[model samples]
Target chain A: MDTLLSGQLLFAALVSGSLYALIALGLNLVYGTLRLLNIAHGDLVMIGAYTAFWLFTLLSIPPVVSFFVAAALCALLGWAVYEGMFRRLLANPGLAKRVEANSLILFYGISVILQNLTALAFTSSSRGYQYLDTVITWQGVSMTGNRLLSLGVAGGICIAALLFLRFHLFGWELRAVIQRREAAQIVGVNLNRVQPIIICAGFAIAGIAGVLVSMTEQITPFMGFPFTIIAFVVIIIGGLGNIGAGVLAGLSLGLIETYGVALTSPGYRSILIYGLFVAVLLIRPEGIFTKAVRS
Target chain B: MKALDIIFGLALAIGGLLVPLSGDAYLMGLVFQLAMWIALAQSWSMLSSTTGYLSLGHAVFYGIGAYVCVLLTGVVPFGVALAAGAAASAVFAGLIGLPVLRVQGPYFVILTYGLAELVRNVVMRIESALGSFGRMIFMVPSFEVLVWCMVALGILATLGAAAVRHSALGAGLAAIRENEVAAETVGVPVARLKLLAFVASATIPGAVGGLALLRTGYFEPAQAFDPVISFTIVTMALVGGTETVRGPVLGALGFTLLSEALWSSLPQLYMIVLGLTLIAFILFVPRGLSGLADRALGRG
Candidate 1:
């Protein structure tokens, strides 16, 4: 238990928490506004990781520079996904009642496609590179500079997103659409314009998180599903569609996982995540921090 | 139409029986897969299609059955082991169905997925702690016998699904799908019906899992509880059309055959093709192959 309270573990938790928060932020945005459960969200992150890896290995460009490019690529993919599949489903007025289930299956298809396509392109092998491997010690706790940089960037982006949602006019429209789609439309919110952008932003954020994750861990075509599950757990903890609360929930879950794994064997990681997830669903189906309407 | 249905059923039964007699291992393997999937997809429809609750954790039931059957192999008769596996899954579903089924829509989907993953991880941990990497069975039944058992389970599942569809229980479950509040108000016994359906849907998969393990002659926790099994189940049910008992049978057969054809040569593109097919089905043929057949027959 002594290790649970150690500064090193605390720093580890913060770093992981930032990554979780960034991952969940995009999922929250997409689900909040579109009502589509993007099971393929993590695959976008994998694409980002691969993007950064290729940029660094082939082009000799740094990951920091590739981050934006990966994000843009993911955003473009998201737009294409919406335009190709979701737009048709959303247009069918008769299918409105079944959209959630329909989209769940559709996104599942997308997830499978993305995973296999990436596997085909990348050979399903794990890939990694040396970037900011230097260890920096502070207050008797040592960590990689890359880890610290990822933490700062992820956290900073989360805060920026929250602020943007609160302050930006477009953010207001997104929140309006999230809070109440029909009401937002009644109030003249341009959903056609807002939906596409939010979906793009969601993918971009997921891509950014993927780049940050690549800094600290190995990347593979199949690495996306676990991250997708993690983001789902975070969003569930924070209350679905509550973008602001996702950050806090993500961080808290990070602490819980880090400390909980420290206390128990690392093999129990999935148990802890799924146990926490199931417990939350059973105990508070409405979520802990906010009563986000179960749309 | 009813006579044609009976003829179709008779022809399928005859084919199932004759396949094993042909003594072709590869063909027997394909038939076994088709039967197993038919049982699984049909069982899944007994709950998810009927009640509008899309569960993504059917693999949990299957894995549990496989684990239990593998453990009980030498200690008990094969039939008893299979029955025990089925009973275990039924009991497990009955225990969790109440609390787990409380959530609806997307929450239910996510919770079921999480629960399956949790169980898979726990099983992995237990296996490792016990110093067992994977279990190998030596005295399992022959392939022909295994295929016969699978065919029986498939037939049983199909009959059960058809019975449920035509019964009052089916009407009540359908009512729940249409509108749960209204179903409850109209005295459909919502909670009890949901649990019953969930347990019923789980039982055959357990038996199927046991038989599947026997067919493979090995059991690994990861392989037994693969989430891909759950995804494939959903895909088959959707692709076959969920509204009729015939749908799952059609879906399982079509998907199994398609996958069999594609997996060997285009292993890399298999999942990609499946994904694209799913998207296409959901977009254009939302009702699935059975629906298309119905329309062709002027019954739609």
Candidate 2:
């Protein structure tokens, strides 16, 4: 039990939780605005991680610069996915359910495509970044420079996003669109312009998460599945339409999962997270935090 | 028309039996695998299409049945073990369905997937207790008997789908799929219908998986609980048109053959191909191959 409070374990859990929160924020953003469950959210993370990896390894770019580039690329991809696929599907509400189903198939296909392409291009060897002297310890509480930096960055990004939503012209318009698409259109919100930006912003956030995760762990083609499921659990646990709930759920899950692994085995950690999700769904079908209807 | 349908079913059964006699082991193996997949796909369709509960954990039921069959092989005759396996799977489905079916839509899908992962992890942890992972084996039945059993089960499952699709219970399920609140208001027992669909769907996969283990004489947790199995079976059901009887069968056969051919050659792009196939079908041919057939026959 004393091992539970070990600085290493606590630090690791915090780091993991921070990363989870980052990923969940992206999922929450997309679901919040679109009311679409994107199973491919994890794959987007994977794409971001791969993008960072390539930029760092091949182009000899620094990790920090690569992260932003990867994020920007993912934002573009997200916008393209919406413009190409989701737009057509949204026109017919009856076909919406089938389109969602098709998205899973398509994204899963994209995952396979990315994984295989990566495997073909750069053989299936596990790759990790060269860690510099980046460890920081204070009074026996140790944390990695990369992790702490990422946490700070995630915090800054989330805060900025909140402010943007509350104050920016497009952000308010986007919120209006989310609240009532028909009403927003009637009230002169240009949905055609707003939807693309929201999706791109969401993907950019997901890409940032991907880059952060890659820094802590090695990148693999199939790493998307576990992360994807984790993000899903987080968004589901946090209300679907609430960003704060997503952050809260993600951090809580990360802490629980980390402690679960510390107490039992890492193998049982995912089971516990899943069990928690099932329990949450059974107890509160609408999620933990309900979004207030905004005027 | 009903007589013609019955005759077509009988002719297919006779054709299945005659295949093994031709001494083509490769073809026999393919046919056997196809039959098993058809059973699985049909059962999965029963739960997902009929009840509108997209379960990503049907493989969990299949794995349970396989594991039970493996465990009971030492205590009972192989046939008895298979029965026990199927029963265990059905019972397990009923138990899991009680809590899980309360949720709807994506929640249900995610929960079922989690359930499958939970089962897999549990199996992995207890591997030493059960015997080492992939180390345990069950004795196989005679090839002739195995073939006949599989064919019988396949035919029964097909008929079961047809029956369920046309029954009063089927109408209730359809209503639930179309609109849950309305169905509940209209006196349809939503939870009970879902449970029944889940249990019934579970039975075929359980039996099929048990029989597959019997035929293969081996069991592995990862192999038994593979997401690929879940995805493939679901894809077949959806591709064939979810709510139809003939859809899953045709979907399973075509998907299996397509996968066997493509995966063997382009293992890398196979999943991508499958994903593209699913996306294309959903977008353009949302009704699936069965829907296509219905249109060709001017029944749509």
Model 1 stretches astray by more than 4 angstroms: A291-295
Model 2: CAPRI class? medium
Q: Write the per-residue lDDT of candidate 2 for residues A1-295, one digit (tens) a residue.
A: 8779787777777677777877887877776666657777887887788877777778878668877887899899888888877787666666676544555555655566666766666666777775443778887877778888777777677667778878998778877776677898999988777767777888888888888777778888777878888887887788666777777787788788888888887667756877777777777767876654444
Residue B137: error of model 2 in Å? Answer: 1.0
User: Looking at candidate 1, what is the lDDT of residue A264?
Assistant: 86
List the per-model TM-score of the A chain: 0.97, 0.89
lDDT of 2 by residue, B1-300 (tens): 345446766777788878778767777777787788778887887778887778777888889888888888878998898888889999998887888888877677777877888787778678845558684564566776787788778887887888888998899899998899999998999889988998999998888888888788888888887877887887888788874687888788777788778777877666666777776776678788888877776778
Top candidate, metric TM-score = 1
Over 4 Å off, model 2: A97-102, A179-181, A291-295, B1-11, B128-131, B298-300
- Highest-DockQ candidate: 1
lDDT score, candidate 2, position B136 = 58
